[model samples]
Target: MLLPIALAVVALGACDTGGPQIPEPPGPEQPTTPSQPSTPQQPTTPTPPTTGTTGAAAPPGTIAYARGGAIRLVNADGSSDRALWQVPNASLAATIGGLAWRPDGTELAFSSDHEMATSWYERDIYVVSADGARLRRLTNAPALDALATFPKGTVTVRVQNLTGDAGPYFVYVLGAPAPQQVTIPAASSRALTFTNVADLGNVAQPVVVINGTNRWFGDAVADVQGGRSVDAGSLVVTAFGGIPHYGADVPFWRADGQRVGFIGSPTCNLMQVAATPPAGPSQSRLLDPAVFGATCAVDWGPTAATADQIVYVDERRFVDAGEVQFFRVAESARSAGSPLLTVGRYPRITDVRWLPDGSGFLFARTNDLLDQAVNIHEYVFATKAERQITNFTGSFVRQFSVSPDGQQIAFERVTDLKGPSDLWVVRRDGTGARLLVRDARAPAWNPRLR
Candidate 1:
């Protein structure tokens, strides 16, 4: 699912997103009156640029979704969908944030309510077996221990947006005896590498790959060992008039762990920053100056060609047609970036993610103003074909998460009523449809996890 916090980086009332750093909907204290029409309809889904390429067909591993107060996993086709685990406090009506599969494919990591705090604000990280046994709390505190991604092992790197306004990005390492926390200040270099775990009493520590422009702290390992608290302040920088240097959108980190990319605050242009070595120097530059009013979706991992290679979507909504262009950049290459794909015309295309094998990507196509219905599409790199993955009407297709193997998908089904969201699973080939639960937020397939 394209989470408000995970993929929906920032939320502007007019451009309000669903990211974690986005502050809660302003309370009644703040008042505003805008031009109104007879219809008081909910915000409609936005359009996504069209992808010329297409293809489809496939299947795989157990898919995990949310229902009631439990995290459930079903077979690829949605059959055998059973409860893997449930939040201990059923009365809390806890909301699941994001789900990540362990590298070996035995356990899953996710963010959910740790207790009955009476608010979604109190979320924590957790790990569970594929069958729903041995549930362990990875984090137990009030802070938001959100966003857990397993690159390729028992290790999971979690991202914490300390400030509600997208301030500091507190990067945490899980799957370790004691998870480590470090803060990357606003504008820190796109790349922040976490290494040298020998000093921290661990034989091997998972590499913490993070992206941003300005990093004030580099020695997070030593700090973690020394018992230091990362005070991820807040975002408070403005360059062009009221444009902020740091917006609510999340930074894009390449799966290769070589570089990180993000949107320039005031300019809205895309910037690529080096994933600086632990406590070392790095560089920051624009991926494309021509792409203005743009922000990145997520890292679909690197192409098989090289670690520097990355496939990302650029949203340039300022132009008359609102272009959503896809580019694959190889830092070592002389060319600024290789333009891979672009939305047909007008309507914006958002939420583009790489398939498991990196051969293609999945995305949603919606009309401008996001009012009309949405259709999910998949593009195959090998075939240069674009195939429609879903068929729905009226309501929108919130988002889709691909499994590690790239055969099956877990996606969100949204309606205008603001009612409970439905969680569904479909094969990559677009067959075998089934609903796992209702009202779940983020649904991620277990990648190859141990």
Candidate 2:
């Protein structure tokens, strides 16, 4: 079954129609010359407009999107656009939701309708090459396939297979010929096993599982233990109470995957569990109640070696109303603190992604309450400089991705909810902004050597 999407509603209580606007920065004062004889005054050299120093300008790449049961590819500058692939009239009943580019940037994977009769209730994963040369179907089962994450060289998907009246589905890892189902053995019918796979390597390692009913959540990291040729896996269990919901609703994993963190409501208190050997019980620690006192959204930063940060939305009285904040996990661990820094604020932030070097991150920000005005902002941690890349007035942007080189960004912008959302790209310095793809939602940049 497809998961429910979260919606955020903003209510402005009081309005100040006569409030004064913020003034611009004052200009530099003019200097006066001496009365005595002086050398001829030299004209000041005008400064050239600054260009993005990150990379050399190259022909912008192409973007692929799905619209009306057909996949479309467009130039980065919003020109010479064409439909790359289209399904038959019978197969166009299901609406395509998620689309992702392969690590090689040569193929696209998406979830679309599997049948015309059951289009509304059934869906499957499909793949198409970048040039629209080849098409392939990955899954054929009756389960609802969603939340697909394509790692560097491998594709790891979260599949929720509907079984009878119960909703106990298993998450599986697929191989070349067949897919491997990973689950924890249960003792009784009441015992439901909840497992979250943190990271999967090419070699043998333990798969993490959270074993319990719906009351508590835990983490189990697997590793090689026994003399078996295929490495033996061990289980670690950590427990917590008052969990908001299951799946990706709450922030769990730390940057290094060594510890899991979460916040419980209606008090909005923070808790964390460290991964120990022999499956020890979870240790509960409460954070400052004031900082995490509001019901806010949380998300993990991009998984980079140097990127170690957790971002959340916070309310800062009247100044921010609703704003986004970032905290450094490394510093929090050193000082035994909850949060390290409070980054600047944005109107609305979604899908925060870090650059390859971990110097900054890119996120989608909407300025209006209706989410019609949207822009992409890059927040640099080191310099504390935030640059706005796009400024379309009535378009909403989603499914954003940053190039591995941290020079270019890709996203989907839609003018109306009933219309198609096209892909767009711009430089890091907010220059040379243009459209890339048409009618795509989820876009993932390739991290391989390009």
Candidate 3:
């Protein structure tokens, strides 16, 4: 159950104003002893809605979302509005975790309930067509399975059982069908080992996997451990977890797979691995530390491009005010090299994603610390501006996604603190706000394949 709004007042204290505050106006002049038996007060006039540069009508190619077991797409610009597809007996039990569109945009990959309970630990990977037709169950596992990426010819999934007694808790790769037990040796079970996988595609050919034993490569078990491997590209560098106490969620490879970036804990300094995998002994060097102050979350820009800028939130003030800060990763390794830019400082930065073109990204910001009313914001990089997309009074925006062309935005508008969440969408400019699907969490936009 979510805490009531009144509780937020006590939790955040009076000093922490979540949103804009309203000032009290001066009281009326002292009246002469209730003159004329207090004449009836006149009703205040209602304020007219202010229209921005974009009018009330939705922009061209606009989409609205609703929630009802599955993601429902509605053509707000037209009359056809209905459920895209139903996941049979899918329940709103567990929250949908993450979503991504295949390069071709014909299919969508997402993480949902792998286990039975509503807890975060129980989740599995599922895929569906763009039009909501042909729902496919990709992974049939009792443990938690998440679809990390579905690159054209192959799909990569991360399966783990933190609570299970079993020893095999790692990520696996599957090439369509046939060989279902394809496991990365670096990520194989070996007591308590930690591994992080990043995709560089075929350009770097072999994917980069950071494991506890040692960083090595090979498609098969023998090639990986025995060192019988071909040079996919240059050996950028090697990054090791710092202290290992804070856990591993740091290192990430750039979209182009040319450079690797990660955060070194204990010191929490931002470091970059410049070597391409499958090369000479891995070499590592520290990058800018100023941009990586107590980093909380980090995401690589889109691949297929050279823009190596990474966005992350500083942990310094995030503990109290939940502010989000953005930094641009430049080539220079100077001390004052990285510049920290402030995107928004209010509420909390929930999720951050980079646009395919590296132009800008969309992020989910919420104010419901105790689960009372959620506000969503769309941050545009080109204009260097942030706009409040959803203004649900007593609900929270669970998860959201942006269209392939970056025109439409879909999200789950969760009402009733203890109830299920529904899917909704609004124009990036805050127009044509409506419900598209119900009982859905993570929504991914399908790319328009040629």
Candidate 4:
């Protein structure tokens, strides 16, 4: 969830005081609230399960959330809570937000406004391994950057020549730009990288033509994390390719993963960019209905079946309801005709997310068009049915995430709108709701189950 609102300053209490580096803040020794357990109403259904847990053991997966100046991870059952990172000096930094999990669920990325020296409001993207061991800052530009998305996985290809004679070998990632020819000396090797992702096609195929001869290697799935190698005996390598710039607010990975859809900065127009290109690259294109305010609430559908679909807030008005539009990707800049559907009309809108299987989507809207108490709702594509998922009498659902199995949802709820938020988890059917953590927001579920 990419909430563009300014980060509210919250004073921190005494943090760990000892070693050269301060330790991450710990999660509540116990769940801030008591547990509420329920049974699975329909265990066989593909929809979210209607059950909740109350176990002392850590649950099946991880849930990452944001507290004042820190990023914390907790279990679905509210156990094994711990912080991954915390701002060293709260006075110079804003709260950590925009939590996005890598497609493989090995790393988590987010944005923070802590580089006050560059600009009091500068925010940059950062990535941290799931274990919180390796952290890397990815961006340093002075901008209101947020919402960094990743594809299913990245691949690095290592090619070597086992042949007696030295010659040129051609390597290509199907559906990407083109093949590049590399000269390899006999018994020597070289590394090639590919953003082999679905955004370009149904799948990414990495192929290598040996020594410019009809003899070849590959047409292989680039699925491994370390990468595939073609050596004199076989090939090997690893590296993080940088993210492509496409004006950064609320960026999301297309169902295919390699391509990204984001709102362009300054103009607020919808834009698309490939995560990483070849040595040379093509320009990213901008799309229509320059978003109504800077909000540009947007999200990509989850599965390959819905790879080209997107749901976003395209219109806003002071005296009338704002429009949420559903669009399909096209080759042209403006795309074509009308939206496939007008997803909804609301006086105020915030976040939008798709179920893991692409059966439907969840969105946040003000109840009764009152624009005060916001709740999360579900929109099923097949039935064209809409149902309210969260009914907080006077509170708002700020940011929320669907579990990897699509059986649960974790969300941020605040009674005062601008007040400190509490994290809550509930069954997909809207039952068995419970507080998972207090004073936390931006709940992001790990993409894979543990």
Candidate 5:
């Protein structure tokens, strides 16, 4: 028998319903004002654009979605919809959530609460073949182990923002020529990035300054490469800003997939860890000299030339509430260089996805003052021009993913925050929008198998 939609999906929300309640694990505290709203609304068909080519035929792959206690799959063309995994009756409140395709696409990894008693459940990772065979439990831990993905490599940096304003802040390695300076805006409160940075050991005294200001902050510099802080005061400080808030959010992967980075919470420092377990121990530091705000989204640039670079969005609340800026942090030499402000600022910008080739990216934004609808848009780095890709009203785009070929996009749309949502596909030029699936919450397309 089909179970009620598993609101207890371990990765999506609180896991206390229908089973023994487990205390949620600690992590980043996401913004509460605008959460990803689930809806039950019907899907809308999009009208094709007059000037662009029709949506390319559905890219070759499968899409995995969960309903009740089962994991299901459907081809990109909406064919062969079938169950991939179903929970056993032996376990109480057993439900599957979270899915990841093995790099070669031969297998899938997921998290589930199938071993729990009716009184309570704990999530664990498991791997199974695409054909639903060779199932193996990978973890039996006491804590949540959902949201599995393959790891990349490792790069680490220590970053902090000491100024008060949301700045286009510059970081200069002490005694370096003007050409060696790195610029990074406070990406919220404790926003940090790198450029022209070297393993300067004790010689690195990083000072930060905002443009058109005489005040600078860097009274304390340490050996960041060693991942330890020290007291060597050589920099001058004329002024300081009030402390900002810090909270955690799901971190984003670097382009090489070697390292994962997130804006640290409570202290607001920019933090990173190796994608996979590193040879040495991982350390955490609190660099909250002052508060910035929050930076919740990041997308790494594509292509070899752009691999070490990234594009992200962060908001500054008081300078006209809802102010958002898009930035690019590029790596030069040992330095990650400065954070370059890209294109235009908006009232809001979220859900950034880089184009397959790194020419630009796709993002979701609210164009009007009422912020009634969030539409998808394309921003080209070469032209610095932006264009709307989806123009539907009264609907909030919950999430979206780009097609492998980069010719199309798949997005979840909701007309009512309290209603159920559906999936839709559209062409790169904003044409040929059509409904793909109904009653689907998270739509993850399978990687193209070799």
Candidate 6:
């Protein structure tokens, strides 16, 4: 359960950097009072499962989402479009939220509704193949299941359940026959993790997608948690917990899947605390000294010299108002961060993300929207050059994610901030721009989308 809204945006805190660091200030640990509290009911009959196989091999990169009664997949170039699963009057949008692809690109998982549950938010979990075959329903429930994720280095995928009946909303990582349930109450929200999660996908680089609610929260799922995870062949910590992060939940699975980043105190600073996984009460420490009182936008980068570093936007108050500054730093050496060059005077940066290829990152300055309405830009670190990817008018690109191939980007655009939205994608250089799905909430690129 989430806390009250007013309590969520409060005073700044401290970070534990090993030796003698001050205790973290109590963050705004409030969950908003949901407008609609749902009723609890049992599951009606689930539609019979069906499996579709594609021996033709998925195109170099595939983009998929739950739509019009099925899971839809299309190429990055908008060619070869098809549905992996088709359910009459059922869709993943109701609960699953977005598309989660397996690491090997062999399977994909999402939440879909076959039966009308107590509320529209309640749905079931299903996994299908890259070719649309081996369709298996992973979960059957009477509660809400949203924000499904395939954490790197683990066999199981994590799913969220906003239970009715005042039951504790939990994050469950299912493997084999049973599920390892990690209940994250409104309290102890310092961090969240899944316990007993086994390996279901190829163990490449272990990463966990951390996302949350709030406006400036943006889409920073980046932040590499250093060391200790299932990917490392052992769990240094034990327990799993996290709060319900909404809207811009672009999952950043950093270093070994144990590291998770969170946003705090927007007024005092761009407050962020990196919670190391394995799940315990005291697991989270301030990533570094909370230098940037309101650290607005933050993205994680792997440094050859350092373990994991960050590029973030720090927003501060002036004599009369506020200001935003952009920087890149390794928390170990946080004495005055190395600043990144920007176009205008103090560009307002949000949704900072490293390109999949790691050459640079994509960010947006709402202030820039005045000259050019709603566009995505890339900042190349090697050359310190910024390039605009999307050139449009009057469209606010709310959230976006890059293809695993680093060739294309998917984003949600709307005329007004609260108006209806459509999902659009374009090439890295802004060549192929078109609409892929309409009225979509979260548009995530398949990890296998290369």
Off by over 4 Å in 5: 1-56, 66-71, 85-293, 302-304, 317-321, 330-346, 417-419
230-325: candidate 1 lDDT, tens digit per residue: 221222222221212222222444554343444333333344433332211111343434432244354435344434555655554326455566
Give the better candidate number (1 or 6) by lDDT. 1
Model 3 Cα lDDT, one tens digit per residue, 1-450: 111111000011111111111000011111111000112221122113222223455433323232434455444333355566554557454333345554555555444442322111122334566677655533221122222332223323233222222322222221111212223233233212112222223221222222222222222111121112222222111233111211111234455434444433223344443322222112133343333354434566664553445665554545566544666554342433333455433545545556556666666555534435555554555566655555556556554666655556676665543356655566655455555544555555544412
Which tens-of-lDDT digit does each residue in 268-314 have in candidate 6?
Answer: 22222222211111112224434544443565563233226666665
Worst 10 residues of 4 by lDDT: 16-25
lDDT of 2 by residue, 235-347 (tens): 22222321221211122344443433433322233433332211211223323334433323333444545424545444333254433444444313333234323433235
lDDT (Cα, tens digit) per residue for candidate 5, span 12-73 = 11100111111111122221110111222232434432222234644566777656567788
Superior candidate under lDDT, 4 versus 5: 4
Q: Which candidate has the top score in lDDT?
A: 4
What TM-score, to 2 decimals, does candidate 5 have? Answer: 0.51
Candidate scoring better on lDDT of 2 and 6: 6
**Against the unseen true structure, what C-alpha lDDT does each candidate score?**
0.43, 0.39, 0.38, 0.51, 0.45, 0.41
Q: Is candidate 2 or candidate 3 better by TM-score?
A: 3
- Candidate 4 lDDT, 305-338, residue by residue in tens: 6666666555534235444454444323244356
Poorest lDDT segment (10 consecutive residues) of candidate 5: 7-16
Question: What is model 6's C-alpha RMSD?
Answer: 16.3
Clashes of each: 54, 3, 27, 6, 29, 28
Report how far residue 178 has shifted in candidate 4, in Å. 40
- By the TM-score metric, which is better: model 4 or model 6? 4
